[model samples]
Target: MAPGTILLVDDEENILQSLSRALKLEGYKVETSQNGSDALNLLKNQPIELMMIDVKMPQMNGLEVLSQAIKMHPDLPVIMMSGHGTIETAVKATRLGAYDFVEKPLTTEKLLLTIDNALRFKKLQDENKDLKDQIRERFHMIGKSKCMLELYDKILKIAPTSGRVFIFGENGTGKELVARAIHNNSTRKNRLFCKINCAAVPKELIESELFGHEKGSFTGASKTRKGKFEIADQGTLFLDEIGDMHLEMQAKLLRVLQEGEFERVGSSETTRIDVRIIVATNKNIRQEIEKGNFREDLYYRLNVIPFIVPSLRDHADDVPLLVEHFLKIVTSENGKQPMVASDKAIEILKQYQWPGNIRELKNIIERIVILFDSPNIDENHIIQVLPLDGHIKKTRFEGKKPLRDILRDVEKEVILLQLQRNNWHISQTAKDLALERSHLYKKMKQYNIDRGNNSY
Candidate 1:
């Protein structure tokens, strides 16, 4: 197969003919244009992997064509050639985005080498662009509910500022996603985005982990190291679960935020940094402050721009969209053809309380995609994958609630789920749950389940 298509533009017919023969003999498909106008037409009409243009052409000079071509396809690789080549002209071409400049009476060997290098560079550039697109897709938020739209607007307004952000939400509600969206849109986006989970890290080592440490600062301190703050200088540092941080460490962190500097463990030398701080927690920070678990001053300092990420249950209307998004992603990852959820399946998924929120939804979708071999997932598939009985442990099992109340809550959830699955047809729901029609009606009345939201 031909390696790639090459476009050669020159005013001289003989030069074009000779160059075309040389490139074709080396397994390249070549197109020749006698002037800049014809060359541009080729570029516009078809894909040209690379181009070699003479700098001195009639009507329109090679430089003019090069400029316009760059505008049309900014990443196109172009080489400038001229029998009357000058250092000044070569510099101008290079500055105009020419891949490389070659002089006329070009040696076949050198010409081939230049073309090879340019093709390799072009491949690398294309790969880099693809990788960035993949990253953006991976972190892309999928929702169109009113709450999500409002949150998106808030993120856009807050991203350009350098203010400290405090994001609050339940676990699995994507609080870290909010932080990431802010950092990716901020002025420091091109820099590092360092993150550390305050709750996951040990209290004894939290200080060193944040501020780094000097060699011999303590046992296992083998070498001098920089902390998240130092490494994230001029970027953004995400402190996840900041409410769980020790009070002493919170004081130290408060000082760093105030003075913009800190000393490494076992050293008194202060190191200053310019980092954007974004903190996230699933706990109620105000309650933490009132209970004396978190610092009130630090809470006020970091809460300059507060964000609340709504839990999945609050935006149940977006569940169908989220299901489709996860289905495509999971199927693609597993090298399988894309699958879709049936309407009934989606309805059952939406009715779920999602105590674990979006994270749980994604996990269940992945499990379904892997275990089931169907192109369309129906309600039975979801019922098989979801642990419907125990899915409410997180939402209904708070220690303060009595056992009787907890059982009652779980019973209500199960009955409601069954009702939704049966499309609120009371008889069908009663049969599915093996309950008498009168008993089901009594339970519905006790739980306030009504036909207002669904047809009976």
Candidate 2:
């Protein structure tokens, strides 16, 4: 596909033909107009990536078009050209957001260079804007409850500091989101916010993953690698599920926290890094330390500034806001029109024990938005969409076709919920459910329970 469309406006037909041919040959889509009125019409009708307007045009000069275009498309890049160019006119065009001013004897090389630079600048502006939006969306703590307000106060107090934070909550209570909120609001916001799951990485590889590896470090180590600590240097490193890390890895991690240095795997040289540490776990730190699953020293080191994300039940009043927020996002992403959840539906959503917390709520909302095509979401629709927890066991029996069919659905849902709670770790899920790995695999296949790219 062409990179972008460039609109060329000039009273001179020769200039229009020449520029259009040049831009198109360079793999750009080009549109041409001989008058400012036609150029304005095209700008209003179609998306133009970059526009070149002749300043000395008949009927509505480039300056006038540029001024009006700024109101219509504030971010659009427009370059002005004039054979009768002047310092005053150039200054005026620049003030009106013209990308650049060019003389009418437009050099192909100079014009192309200006266009390239302007486009690149605009792209950077757009990317920065997008990053800001994502930061806002990812860290938005959607609640106005007193507890949430208190949590926000704490986040605002600690985010700008260089303190290490230890966040604890039940699974899916938005620990990761809390970590991101800290990073997004911190002094290191412009730098990287690297994350790694202590439970996700293999026991043997967790060290190399944190401290990096030299070429030929171990089996399949074909290239030198920079670990999360190095990549997140001068930024933040989030250690998720920190309680699940092996005891041996805990010692090495403690050393990094104390000394801020570690040698790469299979390399003698040590490297020092500056990273703000943020660790999170669903496990109780004191209990884990007593049981020898986690290190007491490491626990103390990470708990410099502790944060406990509130469970969804603790702030049930936020359900309406969260429902609205997720519904808007879900529908817009799915190319659907806005849908409103009834007030009673919101009240019913508040009555649930959200064991899986915000993540679970988001998944439930996404499923409902996709499955239910109706514009209005009522209590009946919500009761059907909510999880079949033991609280609503009778609801599951409603309108059942057959006893065997209901058992199959219950089996599938129970297994799926277990897998989701365990983050889709098949072995652990099977072990917890008291099933052999082989049996678990057979059942999963029978029920079409695919872990890959499947959301709970």
- Could you say which candidate leads in TM-score? 1
TM-scores of the models, in the order given: 0.73, 0.64
lDDT of each: 0.90, 0.87
Please, what are the lDDT tens digits per residue for candidate 1 over residues 309-397? 99998998999999998888899999988899888788778877898999999999999989989999987688668776644536457
Off by over 4 Å in 2: 1-108, 388-456
User: What tens-digit string does per-residue lDDT give for candidate 2 at 289-341?
Assistant: 88878889988899999999999889888989998999988998899889998
Clashes of each: 0, 0
Error of 1 at 9 (Å): 6.3
lDDT of 1: 0.90
Model 2 is weakest, by summed lDDT over 10 consecutive residues, at 387-396
